[model samples]
Target: MTTTPASPDSTMEAIGQAVIEGRAGDIATARQKLLDIWSTTGATGDPLHRCSLAHYMADLYEDPAQALAWDIRALDAADSLTDQRVQEHHTALQVAGFYPSLHLNLADNYRRLGSFEAATEHINAAHEHAPNLPQDAYGALLRTAIEQVSEAITQRNTAKRASAPGHPA
Candidate 1:
């Protein structure tokens, strides 16, 4: 018996699942697969495909700088999408509707890089766009994550300011 190969969409989905569900030991392989998909798709691939690939790729990096680069790419890909393209991909969410989560991820990435100002900007963008998001499991989780990250960023910035010279304790 022989099995047919998975389509690019299925393959990408599988890679995304592995990255989301896999343990730390599994990341290297998942990252390589995601990279292979990205090489095939390039910048001109389906906007949804590029967005998904870039979004997952961001999580595979250990370095915040590298992750930020991928996050920016993901946001760009998302911005390039049209409502028709979003429907074509059957993503169950509109193109504009992805901004909140994308912005949230950007905020997290900026916070990781110690750019609190940039992080705060993205956090505000995320909150502004969040109401358009679908009421799905992932949407709820992203909302919760955004709230937690926003609070963490605020706390960190406060601590940093308090530690600075000549600042009142």
Candidate 2:
């Protein structure tokens, strides 16, 4: 018997896993594959699928500016998803539950670019919604990451002030 082709959702999940697992070498190739899927889905694809594609796409970039763009797109796609649509993929989709992590990532992206204010803003947003996240390993990880980033920003700003002229060390 011939094997059946994978469904779009399955294909998207596979691609997302590959990216998360950090497949060695030629990340561009993997990103291109994601782009192909994205092209097929366009703006009207399953919101969860679009969000996943954009979220993973953000990680593939070395430049903070580029990554931030993808992050924004991912957030937008997530926001566009309706409660009914979310329920459709709820078993496989936690887009609503992922807001904290998404904001944390966006904060990190902004911090890397030395945009401390924006980073702090996103970090606050992450903290605001973090309590809603399930108390699972992934949720714990995101919470820890948010705290780490927040501390880093605080230290960086303090150091910057200390080094400025007329400021006490």
Candidate 3:
């Protein structure tokens, strides 16, 4: 019997298991594990892997700035990604589906940082990209979050969103 090596994405997903499971006690360890992989993958690694790692890494940070940095990294990676790469890793995924959530996260982070103008820009981008989202639960969630983040920016509220990941929902 032979065992095939785990693919990079499988390894990446394994490292993020703690965050995905919401294992409250293992978050710090998960962060370090993901960082280890990030160090290996570097900025020029596979875009899908970088995007997934950075996106998951963002959720582990309670600090808005820290999360914003990771989110920005994720978006940058997404910029280099193509639908073909996404499908190779995840057949259900399309590149267009990635933008709304990415922009929404940026908007939320900018709003939290009190950068209302930047937040507004991102939120509008999210809204504009929303039609690309599939009419599914994930899409619905992002749409709702986009609206919520947009409203928070309008109100000039810097408070963390209740629905935000790692926000002690």
* lDDT, residue 102, model 1: 84
* Candidate with maximal lDDT: 3
User: TM-score for model 1?
Assistant: 0.78
The all-Cα superposition gives candidate 2 an RMSD in Å to the true structure of 8.8
RMSD of each: 8.6, 8.8, 4.6
When sorted by lDDT, best at the front, the candidate numbers are 3, 1, 2
Estimate candidate 2's alpha-carbon lDDT, on a 0 to 1 scale: 0.71
Each candidate: what lDDT? 0.73, 0.71, 0.84
Better of 2 and 3 by lDDT: 3
Per-residue lDDT of 122-147 in model 3, one digit per residue for the tens?
Answer: 99999999999877787788889988
Clashes of each: 0, 0, 0
Tens digits of lDDT, candidate 2, 1-169: 1123323457556666657543564576777887888888887777777777888887777677887898888888888876555555444444567788788778877877799999899989999988867777766767787888788777654222221111132
C-alpha lDDT (0 to 100) for residue 20 of candidate 1: 60
Q: Is candidate 1 or candidate 3 better by TM-score?
A: 3
Q: How far is candidate 1 from the true structure (C-alpha RMSD, Å)?
A: 8.6
